[model samples]
Target: MTDQTEPVGEVDALMRQAALDAERLLSGLRMFVALGLGLFFLVAVKPADALQEPVLLRQWAFAGSTMMGYFLLGLLTWILSARGLFRMWGVWVVATADTLFVLSGLWLSLMNTGLEPGAIFVFPSAWLVPLVLAFAVIRGDPWVMAFTVAVLCLGLALLAIGGAESGQQGRRETLDLFLSLPPNVMRLAMIALAGIVLVTAARRVRRLLLRSIRDARSRANLTRYLPAQLADDLGEVGLAALQRGSRQEVGLLFVDIRGFTGMTQEMPPEKVSEFVSDYRRRVSAAAEKTRGIIDKFMGDAVLIVFEGDGAARRCLDCGLMLRADIADWSKARTMRGDAPVRVGIGMHWGEVFRGVVGDANRLEYSVFGDAVNIAARLESLTREMEMDVIASRDLIATAKAEAGSLGFIDLEPIEVRGRTGALALSGVAKDAPLRSAGTAAPVSGSSS
Candidate 1:
């Protein structure tokens, strides 16, 4: 399984997904605007007879082409979004396409008017530039808004230059009073200033959107640790599930950082915080790989729960991965002249009481039984035994792995605190691979 080492990449990926979802919805609206509604406006605004002429015919065709392009693009984006094939680049491309089409329509108007290029700004289509640029603010990216503005300014500038250089100096008398080079330059300046305003607006909107998405993702991460089935059982979907307990066979895993208390006692608060965050991130990656849910964490210790079929197998894999990963981390720290770190993992498989408690204000999903207690106790045993990993015989047997497989070595029954009887167990080292063989002991045990 791929490991999630960098959280920033994950957050950026989430933002892209959110942007594509918004784009798909915007595409649906664009479909409506491009076809029926646009046609209604076209028919009411322009006389049908005018389109019969060659010049008007060309403009009409361009408008029709723009509409068709809009419809097709909208449909394509919707289909891609449905298939989960659309990417952030596609969003930028669509923004560029729409901007091109809007400006192209106005560009087509200059050829139809039979007037000087100075009259291009006087044409009614010129009003659409700002409106289309404003439309990009919905995209929630300041860069896309800036891109639209760049394209718009470039198109308008080219049109103005072409008008000044055109061989035909003829102009419409009605607009001659206000359509001089000075007025056109002033209008271009206004467009530039308006672009700045829109870009500023986009930045503010995008900042709020990113902040909201980050906050939502933080809350969503909690659900990842709390399984959906557990949530369903905990009254998130219905009130009936509240204050009720259900029995579930689960693989319980408990992890504790070796010497964490002493390590933190010597470090500053900021350093301790950074160290703990890094430690949790490492364990979380291992848990994610094994499909284990971290039920709860207290500073340097975490309680993970694996349920259903193969829970024991996954739990063991999680422990093995965690130990291996933490070992690598410790080595990296040692090379950097920082204090080394280690973790002890304990695993047990048994039935537990699982359920939620409290009101709408607060709720907790608690897994309580001998299984959890035994798992925590075994973790403490790791320090005394000089073992990085340990599991009860019952857990190993449930995994159904063969002896000398999965790095499991049979061990004599070990006395655990708060327990009257000694429990049969298995042990492994930090560097051992989960599926690799290890020297087995003569002590009797179950399948594992």
Candidate 2:
């Protein structure tokens, strides 16, 4: 079984980072609110001391202290984010602390000012609860939003109960003054409504984020078996396209590392893995450069396909590049006193059936047709012909690639296994140069 810890860990880390970013954004807004409130107290309100009372001065001091605490908490949030510790746990701790701060500040305001329930509703700090709720919702976690709402509601309920007990007479006296609108009831109602909306929004947002993370992880996993571009294309195809198979004329290219079995027989398993890894990387690079999509890796061979316009030309170009790349790799290995490497490639162009197959639970995208079989046979025949690269004559003709430009030697038609009539083909030397379709001349080589 393939170990999935690495990809899962990566997705988890991204989610944590996103959560931290949301926290920092909310913290910055909190700091701005604190600064605005502090400035309002210092600049907007005037001290009317005609009655020689110090109540206003004390009120200013309390408000300043509360705002200072808010600012400091925002700063702490920033510090935690900088240290990379503002994750889910940090969210719980910081949210709890903020609830306590707001509750304590409100309690002190009620005790000192003797404000009735109606007056408390108009206080600047009363809006902090909704702001905190908004922050929790933006964090995209339903549980965190639920916790914030519970704490806010519990604190407010406790305060309301205590206020009613102590100031029953005051509220009763004002009952006649404000008969149509009850501030306490309305305030609690608004809190409930906001919590419902915010929590619902948070739950929806959480679902979306979860889905996006899953999609990103799926794309990453696909790239492990397919090329990056092909993985992206598959994602765009979606479930509908995958459910229905499609057929199109495509260029098929098969590549196999020559004598790989004999080479690995004398080497350690680690060395064999290194050799295969290097070979696959080189093949992938060549395929990408030529716009070929790798179909699958069959042990020591790689099957790639090219579709869309000019696929045949792309397949031929990929084969030539693969030959050159392996030649360079073989020379480097020989210099290092390592086993010399060689690779074989076969290219053919024909109609291919391409789509997802297998059961619903194990659907796989694949290519199937006689063209694939012919490409495989040609790759196997490379060993018998003592050549590194071979392309079907039909592929060369379809691509309109000049033999001189491709620097390939035209070879006699050879019979392929399980196919009627002989198939004409051509071979290219491993160290050929890249050139356009009509400008360059062919390099002399034996057709042996």
Best by lDDT: 2
Q: What lDDT would candidate 1 get against the real structure?
A: 0.69
Summarize candidate 1's per-residue lDDT along 272-376 as a digit string, tens digits: 989999988887877777777777788789999887656788887787667666776787888788898888888888888876655555656678888799899
TM-score of 2: 0.54
lDDT of 2 by residue, 234-352 (tens): 55556456547788888999999877789999888898898889888888888888877787888889999898777888888788766666766777777788887788888898887
Q: Return the top candidate by TM-score.
A: 2
Error of 2 at 217 (Å): 4.1
Q: Positional deviation of 314 in candidate 1, in angstroms?
A: 15
Model 2: per-residue Cα lDDT at residue 234? 56
Per-model TM-score versus the true fold: 0.50, 0.54
Residue ranges of candidate 1 with Cα displaced over 4 Å: 1-6, 35-45, 48-65, 79-87, 163-168, 173-362, 373-422, 425-448
